[model samples]
Target: MARTRIIEIDPLTRVEGHGKVTIHLDDHNNVDEARLHIVEFRGFERFILGRLYWEVPVIVQRLCGICPVSHHLAASKAMDSIVGVDCLTPTAEKMRRLMHYGQIMQSNVLHFFHLSSPDLLFGFESEVEKRNIFGIIEAYPELAVKGIKMRKFGQEVIRATAGKKIHGTSAIPGGVNKNLSLAERDHLLQDIEQMIEWAQEAVAIAEGYCVDHLSLVQQFATFNSSHMSLVREDGAMDLYHGVLRAIDASGNVIFDQVDYRDFNDYLMEEVRSWSYMKFPFIKRRGNLDGWYRVGPLSRMNTAGFIDTPLADDAHQAFRAFAGGRPNQMSLAYHWARMIEVLHCVEKIRQLLHDPDLQGSDLLLRGERREEGIGVLEAPRGTLFHHYRVDNNDQVTFCNLIVATTNNNEAMNRAITQVAKAHLSSQKTIPEGMLNKIEVAVRAYDPCLSCATHALGRMPLDVALYDAAGNLLEHRVKDGR
Candidate 1:
């Protein structure tokens, strides 16, 4: 009889919050199963009840410090429909778009340079202590400086558009609370050219990295799945606003121009015993057959074209590597992320030139409706915020499908694939093999804090089971 063993990685390092990986081995030491588990829970949906509709935007922004602007704007958009406005003032719309672009720029750079770059710059098997931003700075000081300055420029843009960078109160029901002043606009423009140059360079570096590691990019947690994102009427990528679009693994359009309110018609959520995060799937395909992905890779695959000229050219080069198929390579997420950062820089420059950004018509007063649904493409992916109000304008029901939750099923599937590829039939699992599994999870850039919405301290615990379902090993990390 063959002996069985298990491998567990607790509190996946360099991620946003607490999560774990558990790989079960069979009698033959073959990989039996793998799971990515979210261990925390936050009941934001239940706690928001009885609050005023307008307060929802402010309260929900506390979901995650990294992407608070996404929740802030998504909640504000939902409240806008409740207040009976179909469209915001020209200035309000432009200002909100600017703020959103800044959020995306900063977020993309943070992930590419601070969180994920270590894996790319240093070998995946490099020393854990040395695989970090400081290491990158020591080796390539110029590139590190550029990334820092680029992120700083994005944060400054956010501060200029909104009152502050994180948890800003600029977006409100029906419109924004403030507009961008002429001086503020001019100040932001000062670094636009340099930001664009840095973004373009980043894209080239990412593309080169993908090319250099072509084999790893092709095989690392790569599999076929459906892709989803919001797109303009012409099928151009629109991060701030658009209709929902989904495509299958073969690049066939599954659905297009979907309204946010009618999302229930095509999407459904499944609760898993192993995870606090809900798995979302396409209703038409059912649970097992309906798993889809969101975020940079999904967004790049679903859209027909990027509107910005420079980014559009870069996008074409990105597609050429896939040979006209949906880019299913999971590692290419880094490439897609850099492309998005380029698009955000170009979009920000264009919006800064618009005179409407300086207009004084900031707010619109209106009556309340019984319900409202707000949807927008966040830095991670599509984010949904729905709310129902009582006669007194108090919230009665709230539902939020965060970006990380939408990709939960896909992430688990990817983890299983990585475990099978690297750990199956192995008598001794190396630390590098475990790091590869974490790399699969990191590729998705999941935000567990936002996905679980949990309060209090978070801890990650991973337990491995033998073929007889006996706990063989356990690893735990206290996130507090």
Candidate 2:
């Protein structure tokens, strides 16, 4: 009789979600199947149903520490649409874009150096402790310092442009609450320059990895579908807000730019019973064939071209690998992240230089309650926050579409692929492969807190079983 094997991760820690992964393998080295599950339900929608209109941003920003800007922008956006007024003037619009650029820079850099770099530079066999950002502190301190400085400088811009570092209250229904003082502007520019230098060094280091590890790229870059992102009809990178456009896997442009109302017509969410997260794909293409990815690579693929100069250069380098198509391998996320970092710096510099950004009045105060939706390119991907308010300015409906939700189908497919590739009979059942599969999902850097808002912590029970259904191992995880 051949031995049966199962790998289970119950209640994954150090990240969002009561998440788990299960892998089952048959005797004779055949891999049967795998699943990625998101447990627990918090009715964030129900919690906000009766709240005041302006309280939306305040309430939703607490969804996740990693992508609070996404929630804040989305919630506020829904209000903007509902009220039927685009409150921000040219200056306010510029400032909001700058704030959002800072968010994109910090978030993309965090994923690059902290989460994904360890797997790229150090062998997966490297000690788990030494395989994180701290590992870089031990083995390659200068590179690690560059990463830290990059993140800090980007966050400093965020703090100065907005109010708080993580959860900020500057964005409002009509406009922003904060103004850009002269001193703060100078401080922001200085930080932007420093961020530029640090990002350049980080890019060089990543390029080294790209050059040295061809095989890793080959396995990690497998593309399953085409890509999508928000951009202008003229083909410029639209950061703060724009229409959504996507291309099929064959490189044919599907829809150049589609407005949000038509969002459901072109792209729709596929409800899956296995996970709370919904898979987003082009409506007509169907599920298995249509699931496209977002975040770094997809954003790079979908945009007609990048606007900023240095970012354009980096983008040129990225295109040299595989031009105008999805790189597919999750490792390519770094290349996309670096391109965006450069893009953020250059565009922010342009925005600051604009005369409008220096004006005194920052907001246009007014209240008009109507159905509205605000769509912006969150650091991870396109974020949609829709809201409906009654005549009394009370919120009645709220719907949020986050970036992670865009990649749900792909993540499941990836888990199963990783299982088949590495969990066969001849392969060793390593202790941390479950975490590795989960890490693949984290490559998208999901913000779970933004998905919902009600409060409930649930316990976890992970059970391993053989093909015949006999129990092999069981473990329970502590709930919050």
Candidate 3:
């Protein structure tokens, strides 16, 4: 008889914030099950009740240091809709899209190279002694340097748009808080040209590694799941804006225009007894049931056309994965991210060079009611922010549906697969497996802090439970 083995990872780090994962194994050294759990969300949704409408942008943006802009936009878009300020003008729309692209470009680079690359680049079975950022830098200096450049480029875009590298004061309820000058636009253009050159090299670096290490994609790409993203009617990806659409691996459109308010349609959220975060699923069609994958992988699958050259080439390469159509693969997230980054750089270059970008077409505007929804293609996946206003138009409610939340199903399953495959036989799994599971979560670049504080916060202890009613784990965290 095989004895039961349990290996758990707590407090996933090295990206945005904290998370946890646990896996179970059988005596035969096979993974029996896997669970991805997140502890310590202070119920931000409950906390955001009763605040001014205009404050929604500022308050929601505080959800996470790394992804404040997403929150800011989600809330702003929702609020704009509520107040009927639909005419945000083309220039404002272009600028916002430009900034949104930057978020995707930078965050994807960080996840693949800094967080997930360690295990793939250095064999997962290799000694843990030399599998960190410093080690990667020492051994693969070019890749490491590319990672740095990509990250810096992202931050620079954020700084130029929102006035802060991490969080920005602009992107308010109705309109942006600031405008740009011709010189500033010129500078942004120049920077984008340089970044595009660098991105070309970065792409080569990834392709080289990926080609030489086909096993990385082959192994990690196991398992197929449904994909989802926001897109225009013509099936082009709409990063900063659009309606939600989900597509299956067989090139079938599973769902479309899922009303932001009716997200409950074709989607369901199930609470795991072991974690505070809720797992989401596609309202299964027949036997194709259960939660689905989101973020970069999903976005690429859902998108039918590529607008940028590099992204288009990558997309074609991806289609070659199966029957000249994109098949489900976890590592496709890396591919999708690079494609998006390419699109972002090229788009930004065009927008910056445009004559309208240099003018002060942008103007600050306030709103009567602040309650709103901000939605954006966060690097990880579809991110949504919803808000409500009180009598005085103060914030009465804030709810966030973040990117990681979108990939909870896939992240949990992938961790379980790895644990089953690699750690089932061991009496005790290495701390590295725990970290690896966490790395899987970060591969989505989830902004946990922002998610927990999305609705609002109150102090609470998170508890995990099993079928027998045993307490598996528990942790406490504060809400901001």
Candidate 4:
């Protein structure tokens, strides 16, 4: 009789929040299918009902601690529309931009150095015990220190602009509540040059890995799909603000410069039976084929160029490496992410020198509207916030498409590609083989709690089964 089995990996490590993956093997032990299942669900949308519209920007920060600022700003932007403010003052806009760039820079640094560095620096199949941030600290102390300082710099920017690190009240309905003072600016400037140098080195590390493991990067979890991001009108990468744009794998524009407020017209979310996370796709292409990728890789694919010189140069080399086509290699996300880190630091340096940041005009006001939509590129990808406020200023409806949720279909595909390539027909499963699966998922840096709109704790269950559906092995992991 032919052998067949089903493998389950619960509570995928290294990514945010709770989730699991299942891989099915056919009669010949060839992989039949793979799925990344999101098990927990929370009623965050419903949780917003009846809350004052003004409270949304603050409350939404509860979504995910990892990228709280993304939610804060996205909700604030939507509330801006609710108040009918189309454009923010120079000071307000610049402050928010600074906060955003800091958020992205620090988050990327944490992911690249503390989270994924162990895998990249020490091979994905290396010993699990030593394949962690602590391991990096032990072996590469200087690199570890740099990562910590880089992240601290980003957090400090957030503190200056947002008023505090975790969840801040700086951003209000129409604009920011605070601006950077001279002292704050001077403090940030002290580390600006060093941060830039460290960011550039980080990019080199990622690029070196890709170049050294060209074959592995080319084959492992790599596939061509549509890419999407927010780009400046002239097609430069603008992480804080811009119109939505998506391109096919060949670099053909799928949709260009569409206002994110009308995103419902161009995109639709499909609810799958097994996963709580919704699969979002472009409406014109339909659900099956319209699923596109977002985040650093997609940003690199869609942006015409990086506006900053150092980042632009790095971007140019990255593009040339892909022969001027969309880089579909999944592992290349590390390289692209580092490039964004460089861009963020450069923008921070520029913003710190701008005198407008010290301006007193921090807020704006206008006629109120009942409904509003706001979208921005978060650290992971594009984040959308929509709300309907009652006449009493209470939120009547709410919907959010978190960045990680936007990459839902893409992460599943990546996991499947890795599973098939690494686990198919294997007589015995090794921890290293499983780590490869996680490396693929981690490439996208999914935030499951943010995606599923859930909070609180949940247990994890890992199970293995025979072809006939008999459970062969099972393990449980208690929730924290």
Number of the predicted model whose lDDT against the real structure is largest: 4
Q: Score candidate 1 by lDDT.
A: 0.87
Q: What is the C-alpha lDDT of each candidate?
A: 0.87, 0.71, 0.66, 0.90
TM-score for all predictions? 0.96, 0.91, 0.87, 0.97
Rate residue 96 of model 1 by lDDT. Answer: 91
Instruction: Please list the Cα RMSD from the true structure of every candidate, rounded to 1 decimal place.
Output: 1.9, 3.0, 4.6, 1.6
Residue 133 lDDT, candidate 3, scale 0-100? 76
Candidate 4 regions exceeding 4 Å error are 1-4, 456-462, 475-480
**Clashes in model 4: which pairs?**
none
User: Higher-TM-score candidate among 3 and 4?
Assistant: 4
Error of 4 at 17 (Å): 0.9
**Tens-digit per-residue lDDT, 115-234, candidate 3:** 667766776556665766777898899879978887888777777777887777667545665655676676666667768877776666555655676676667625777778787667
**Measured by TM-score, how close is model 1 to the native structure?**
0.96
CA displacement after TM-score superposition, residue 379 of candidate 2 (Å): 1.8
* Model 2 Cα lDDT, one tens digit per residue, 416-441: 77767765664554545544664565
Q: List ranges where model 3 is wrong by over 4 Å.
A: 1-3, 27-29, 257-262, 284-290, 363-371, 428-439, 453-480
Candidate 1 lDDT for residue 408? 92
* lDDT comparing candidate 2 with the true structure: 0.71
Candidate 4, 415-436: lDDT as tens digits: 8898888888786667787788
